[model samples]
Target: MRTRSLTSAAVSAALGAALLAAPAYAADGVPPGQNPAATETTNVTAGSTPTADTPTGVPSGVPSDAPSATATPSESPAGDPSPDPSSSAPAEGTGAPVFGNVGSDPSDAGFLTVAVSSDSAITEVSAKLTQRHGAEPATVAVSGFTLVSGTPLDGVWRSPRMSQLPSFGSYDVTVSARDSDGDDTSASGVTTVDVEPKPVFADRSISPAVLDVEHTHVKLSGRISLFDPISGETSPLGGKELGVSAQYGYSAVTAADGSYAIDVAPRLNGENATSVAVSLSFWIANPDGTNTYVLVDSKTLPVVISPSRIRLDHSSVRIKYGVKASSSGVVEYLYGGTWRPAKGVAVDMGYYAKATSSAAGRFTLTYPYLLSGDTSFTVGTSLDSYLDDPYLTASHAQFKVDVINRTSICFCTSWLDAYSDLHIQGSMNGSDGKVPPNRKLYLQQSADGKSGWKSLGWFTVKSNGTFNLDAYVSVPKGYWRLYSAGSSDYQPGNSNSVHFNRTATRITGFNAGPEPVRKGRTVTTTGTVQKLSGTKWAAFGKQRVYILFQAKGKKSWTQLGSVKTDTHGHFTARFTAKQDGTWVGVYLASGSYVDAESYRDYVDVR
Candidate 1:
């Protein structure tokens, strides 16, 4: 703590109700485990009046017996003044000040008064306090004096706090006045101020000088200063009957060492106080049993409580590629005490993702949930921003994500078994390490060398990342492939290409029966049409085959009889062997497939 020092002699005097004698803050210069710079001299000296005019710096409208306010530097001193202390007489004409009877000054007692001048012409009037004890005289200002009602003469001067002087000495005082033209005169009061040391609080302190509004009590500790002016001795005023009051309701009594504790419930601060300074003024009860109080020293303590914010790691992304982090951080703010976790604080995901704060104010968030085909996305918001916490204000954070397209391979068989049902199988995944489950996979076909891929059919993807489609090859194409129409969390993809080409129908067996037949005799022909699946020829059923006959010397052959293959794919035809030389069986080509012919087997007739 710092003290207010007076330059020259120090005298003891108090102003009216303002406690003008209230001392400037003082220090023993050392506290428990701490050292401070030199303290200022707490001295207040009485006046040696100004020759030109009283130093007009006092604030206006004081208690009775103080000076009537003269013109301030801003207001002209031409019209307002008290003509007589007894009546409400306004002054006339701008003129020099007049002086009257001089009263006793500081040397005689602690209080003094005088008769001075006031008129329409007077600008500013005051009593200036000057000390003459040292080599050079120094002045200390004592303001807020009230004019005595008896008569208007000289204005009295006093300090606002009524604190006692820092040092003991005699003080000479006088009255002075000035007019608009700056002319002035001064007269000395007969009385002089006699100052003496008074006991007070020398070493005092408040624990945790800075505090939170929630603090319920303050710890006050101190030892009173005891000095005897007559005996020239000093001691501690222990076991004193001192007391501290808060707003005249709550108070605490001093212990043996003058230490005390004060309850601070419902803190004495403004409504919106984040940080505030409150004065704890010290006083003691009068020993006269009159229940009156006497002034002491005052110490100011600062009391506080501040809002929260979130810091983000990543701020942008793309949807087709799949985003990595929706939120890379957490909400940090003032809570139980200093800044720490705003744990469990929910962060809003505006069509992007979900998030919540954890330890050390951290949160994890993933993106693109149930939101597809987004060109631009602003999401992962910190709804904590709307909390509007007074100690920690609200803040928000977000990330931007987008969607795009990519290339993927669809799996299909190189050779299609037209006999069996045509089925395609494949898998789906993304670059961001996302293997989407329970998704749809489509089978598509394209023209030989051109045209867009048309979807044939679709199937659901299994948990193992694979999917299959069993579909009939109804509308065949030269090339085929698979597709994945992306979901909200993944991008669209494709599979490797393929084609649908039916294999040729083969002849497994063929025979011409009834060797050496006579004319008009019936001859039977038989054959089997088959398809190779793996290493075995499987029957090609439900198809027609032909038995042909050619005359011995003719190139063209005639169709003797037509027969359809049975379940085993075997066909037989009977015809009259009319001058027949040899017979052959033929199979025809159908949609997107080649045909097969049987080897000639000769049968002769006579």
Candidate 2:
């Protein structure tokens, strides 16, 4: 047979076709009439310089249908061998190509990436997207994958932009990779497409918008709806459970009209919290039987607590030194522009007294005896841990009370002799049951019991709260009283008033002359009346003197006549000397002055 000459173009075309049509492994061990052992050696020898008898095309001993033994493009003498456009065999490895990372790009929603690794060069990479519906699954092929970098056998592949995918649904994705050896591997995964409407809250309100002790429970009501992003439309969503979170966690289900109402009790978690936050959460069931939570809409509400108020019946009180002081009031809290009783609350009254409020918010506090002066006190509400809900602000009110000291005086005029010192004794005591030593006390004199008082002297109080005073008297009579100037612990005090009289007077120079003269003749008796003035005798004007006569053997004296004293205090009287009797002159007492008398003289009537 004449040998046929084949050009390089024909040779390349034939090999490319054979590589496309042949499988990686035949059903039989090797092709008929092909030697498996010398396959490598034959291909190496044919690649050498062509002889005159052999052409540059096919080797002499190789069949036209057999595949080339060159594994890589560098080993082939025809430079790089063109791969078949249709199909290729799998790379020599333990299994098909291994798929690495396969997912959609987060930066570009429509772009998908697939990473595959193989022992030999990879020819193609593609993904199959099957959308899920009610029953049947619709599938669509996504090709046009380009290798990212490096060799195709171990690199990432990206698909073309496919942004028209539906949202709010699930998609089944299968990525396949083929190597230079026509070996194919596929990995299956699920991709979620969420473009559905989101739940929204509208016209939300919190009942009892402000929190107080009375309104601890808050009612939250709102209308829940869904917002469609594609159509820009909103509709009510019913029969869905929503979570409400604040100081406490609560849940509520929407009604058929998409309305929901929930109640929650919120308290102050810290000492100084002005506001609190309440959040609403919505969730939906995913296609893969999993649930997803979404924060559709959240609102921050203000938390305002009412303040406590303390009211007292009396702002100030006056009490005796030994009497107890008392105060009463009502405790209330401000809520909704009204004041309500704050029951079961503790109150701190000044002076270390404490009380609990009654059901009517009434409380009473009793204080011990205070000092003599005004004392300031305060009453306030105490914080209670049990009543944390509807917290109330602390409030207080101030008041004052006064205590007075008691003083007394006693005196006896029977022991007060003429021209003798006046004695006075008394006791001073405080209602507080304390004896104030070294306290100054004043002795006062008043003409009238009510006004025009004059201070006589001052004396210090003893440790036993008793006082005694001995005062020399100059004036005959006056009204006297004891006074005490109060200290910081006690108020001013005064004792009962008294009147004293100690006046002395005498009549001198009395003579009944013409002794024993004619029995029927008239006798004149003269005497001068005087008063004691600071140990000295002074003329006593406007005084009446009585003249008396007594028989020598008689036991009583008889008045002969009465006489009036002149400016010199001398008195004259005319009387008949009947028998031998004693003659005497006397002055009667009047208005704190003592009676005065003259010595008796003997007169004989013959």
Candidate 3:
């Protein structure tokens, strides 16, 4: 066989120059080391290869005069090795194979080359590749090696062509050989491979970068590319997928031109704006027809949202106690320079009342008027999940509602001594079943009960809603009513009107003759007529007074005669006393005074 030299130094120098000044590239968009152009076997020599211990063309770090180490199986039991057709039965007294330099291909990491020599004729050769560190150890078998050296017993071997290894890390390489003597020999060593330095993203952009209520979804677009280490050139990479880290199960595949566009809906979690992460990835096709997912590049994006507002129909209201009141309004959000309804949101109406908005964003809050004062009603909503999107900020509206209590007065009258003050009593109350202390009430009188009303006196209310007053009236009779002026929290009210009659007179110090008057004898009766004037009784002049007599056995008194009072208010009348009876003087009813009567005096008959 013709011999050929492998220039390992030239390959190492070329690879180092390319890697020293490599530019930073996006790792998520392209599968490193799996490029078809980089996997070709053009740089490698075929057939009749020289031994690693040869004086010429020796790999770096391996001494040409170094003695080969004998290959031996490890003491620990190993997994089953791949079956090879070039194996032969074992023979006794045959020495194990010796291993020369063993290493990976520098130009392409897909091939493994080794030098092996045995005392007996060699039959089979294989290599086992195992990952050095991982959660689970990964192992691959590489077989069908071709002999490229002097003889079957001592020769150089090369494994079949392959794509780049799946991962970038240290690997344990075990080269095993079987000879015609049925002897097995193996040697283990470590090798490492790095991912290719290449740019993955040529250009990237996002549409509607700032999100708001009007724009809830974002469009991500970008182009993928690959860098060639040998030529330092970039080209488009197709068949890649783009994804958003914030959105699960969302992805878009790139086109033939390495361009991709995808729409993603992200949640702000009730914040005004949020950041999201997006990534690019591609599937790498392996020599075994399986595919592997590799991430190339990632980026962060920002989003924003609009605020919300609450509207009310009325800013203030007036209501009576025990009555129900309602307030209506709508909830809206700022979107695209317009106000849009925020439906199906929970709103808090003041006083612990809550309501849910309708499809039109309208809501009505109802509550009973239980207080007799001004109350503030605040309706609002906060940042929470509602409708298609959550409101980013809190909003509210305020208004005032005045609740007035209904008032009433129970009025009545009582008669006291004619010489004493007049009496009037009543109870004042409200619909809330409470009487405000020190509430002022007025006693009013009207001539016709419809017009010309005048206040007679004013009184203060008690805690129990009751009041009374002794008022002197100069007018004989008039229409009377109780009135109460309203406060900021209570309603004005009036009691029923009443007609009063006050004109009346009385007689005092009356006498009927001396010695008990004999029967058939003349008797005299005298008295004074008095009337109430300014809370005091005074003598009245020119008033008509009547004198009457009643028999002792009669249940009624007979009117004997009438008399007129002198200017001094004194009146006298003489009459024959013919029976044992009581005699008394009376004043008949008149337009100004109702009537007057005197004390009775008895006469004994002879």
Candidate 4:
């Protein structure tokens, strides 16, 4: 038993005060054994018990009335078994006694001490406590009852290891021990403790800091920071409340590391934009029974939406398709007045037209759509782009398509009826006179294989004859052919159709421009053209003419005079110089089909 000694006078005074203070007790004089005798007193022997009269009284010594501290257990009333004011031993048959201090902070591993004592030998002992807040129930080894006389047995008890320790609270502990005779003794106590707050943190950076929309998915990511001191060990913060809001409804929660992610696909229709924010918060308990919360540092990142540059190999409608990305920002394109997929349309062969954005741009889109007829496209970096003040750029084109007529001869009225009124502007080239200039010419096959004829239609043709023929050729479903017609009407007899399968178009008239020379000088020069004449040379609309001039240096050609034949397709130029000297004569031809090729002739201007 834990004990403290009190001065005799102090003990007497305390007893008097206790009896007076207790509402149920009305005391007169103090009891015995507690006070010193008036003369030198002798200690009470083991067998000799204190008498009812002794030197016990208040300081006044007038035998003041008070409760008696020295009373026999049998002297107590029949029902009341209260101990003598202060008794060292338990009631005669109270059984083996168990004692211990209440444990605390059980959320963490902690020690519990239990001591047992008994008048007789003890048999069984046990400690009883429920596992609360995810802790396992303590084992029997930590809780047992059985004691022997004078054998101060101490039990080392440990609070169970817990998966999740609750906040600071009260917990009860009861220890029960039994003596050899099967008599039970028990003691109970309470311990109040506070579990340490679990380490926590919050996200403090921008979400989707780098927006990417070209892939039809906006990749989102952010930074989460920890305010607590975290080392090698990390605690999971699952189930934390995390919120992310965009121009449209899009939200999500943080994962174990306080990091959160979500995707937002901007509406490709009308306007394309991205505007959003993210927030997070959670709670931890305080020692004083109050709750504290941690909040994420909210951040807003501006989303950029780029205009889609649906590029192609050529701007003409019938041209082959090519792909290229646009500048940064969200953008939408329209097809037949409705929004098109980021990928515009499929052209000839497996090639496709698509609206693409630069890096870090965002766009919401769907799949495989069109871009035809008076369609409109819009692009904006802000959310309110759909209003009347939308940012958009639009244009229009037309096409005049025809069927390919496959035939070797021009079998007009007898073989096939010529169809011509398929006209749409700005997309197809029109024919005038002999042949269209570098325009696509499509042909249709004749129904009768023997006829072997093809006709012209609208399409795209480069100056070099290479083309993405946008023209449609309706044939009678037989063997057909495609080819290029050389320069038309040069002399009315130029090779009109050079079948692609037969051979490449011949460089008919590779020549130079008109020569220039001074008027007073006499100059003579000659120029030549390759493949100048055909079956009807004079009938060809384009005629070859050459001029002569006095050439000063590699780049200098002065004009004198130019000449041409009378429907014979030959020409010559003359010049007269006031001063006589050696002069250079350059030759110039009217019709040429070559890149930077010219002929030069030496002359004397004497």
User: What tens-digit string does per-residue lDDT give for candidate 3 at 193-234?
Assistant: 322323345446665655555666677676665533223334
lDDT of 4 by residue, 1-606 (tens): 222233445333323321110001112221222221111111111111112543221111111111122221111111111111111224445534433333321111122323334444445555554433334533223442212112322222222222222322223445556655455655543222222322322223444563433334444554333211111122444545544334444456667655666565533333443444433333344344444433433444544443333332222222111111222223345434454434322111111223333332233222133222222232222323232112233321222212121111111101111241121112211222223354444544444434656554434445543333223335322333333342331111111121111111122232332233354644454433232132111222233343434343233444555444333234344445443222322222223321111223333232
Cα-based lDDT for every prediction: 0.47, 0.59, 0.58, 0.31
Order the candidates by lDDT, highest first.
Answer: 2, 3, 1, 4
The segments of candidate 2 whose C-alpha lies over 4 angstroms from its true place after superposition are 1-187, 190-205, 208-217, 222-244, 247-261, 269-272, 280-297, 303-311, 319-324, 329-347, 351-374, 381-395, 403-433, 436-461, 465-606
Better of 3 and 4 by lDDT: 3
Range of the 10 consecutive residues with the lowest summed lDDT in candidate 3: 62-71
Runs off by more than 4 Å, candidate 1: 1-202, 205-275, 281-311, 317-326, 329-398, 401-606
lDDT of 4: 0.31
Off by over 4 Å in 4: 1-130, 133-136, 139-197, 202-204, 207-274, 279-352, 357-606
**Which 10-residue window of candidate 1 scores lowest in summed lDDT?**
68-77
- Candidate 1 lDDT over residue span 1-606, tens digit each: 111222222112111111111111113211122111111112221222122343322212211111111100111112112222222212644334454433322211233333444343444444544554656655554444444322232232222221333344545555455545455655443234544333434345655555542343555555554333323334554555544443233455566554454555334433354443323433222222212123343445554543566777767665454234354676776646677766655665554466667756677766534233344433333343442232334466656656553434335223356554555555565544346643677767777525787887777777666666567766654666667777665667766454446664555457786887888888888889886576466898877888777786576778877789999899888888778466777776477543555655557677
TM-score, cand. 3 vs. native: 0.39
lDDT-better candidate, 1 vs 3: 3
**TM-score, cand. 1 vs. native:** 0.24
Q: What is the TM-score of each candidate against the true structure?
A: 0.24, 0.31, 0.39, 0.23
